[model samples]
Target: MAQVEIYDGEGDELLFTGQFDFLPRAGESIARNTDDYFHYYEVIDVWHREDSEAGRFQACLAVKIVD
Candidate 1:
């Protein structure tokens, strides 16, 4: 397990940063050749509650391969 940083990489800005105990859904190859590959990813769940105008998003998923 490692701390994988999820960066948008569009405008050199950080989107959402969090600590995931396990790798994202599909994950990558253990082999050195395909080390930079990711098969699947999903936001399992999210919960937010505030005193004013709170918001919550749940089970958002995206399938993407990282290179």
Candidate 2:
């Protein structure tokens, strides 16, 4: 599994952070549900980091707001 940090594509605001089996690429879309509504985002950029810990990696994904 890999750790992922999701951020708003327009700025530095962080949206979510979690672990995933694989990293998402640019042009992919991700959705999340909140208390009142569902939100969607389009992946715009992805940055990867190789951690010192064995078999562990971290990635940052920038996503644009999507309806």
Candidate 3:
């Protein structure tokens, strides 16, 4: 599984956070919520950084608004 953090088009405001079993590749689209409306976001980047000693696993994703 991977942790997904979604942000606005400008990457300013953090809109939502969730988890999924598969990581989305670049150009892929995924549904997300903003305010109360759902929208699709095109995957821009997927980063995985883990710290075994600290027991932390990070999965950061960058996406663009895709109506």
lDDT of 1 by residue, 1-67 (tens): 3344443333433344445565554333212123575433333323222334445322212223233
Off by over 4 Å in 3: 33-36, 50-53
Given candidate 2, what's the lDDT at residue 67?
Answer: 82
Q: How does candidate 1 fare on TM-score?
A: 0.26
Considering TM-score, where higher is better, how would the candidates rank from best to worst? 2, 3, 1
Task: Residues 1-67, candidate 2: write the lDDT tens digits.
Answer: 8779998888879989978788889999888878888888899999976778777667899999898
Model 3's number of clashes is 0
Q: Which residue pairs does candidate 1 place in steric collision?
A: none
The parts of candidate 2 lying over 4 Å away from their true place are 49-57
RMSD of 3: 2.9
Error of 1 at 22 (Å): 1.3
What are the lDDT scores of the predictions, listed in order?
A: 0.35, 0.86, 0.75
Question: Which candidate has the top score in lDDT?
Answer: 2
Q: The CA-based lDDT of model 2 is what? A: 0.86
Residue pairs clashing in model 3 are none
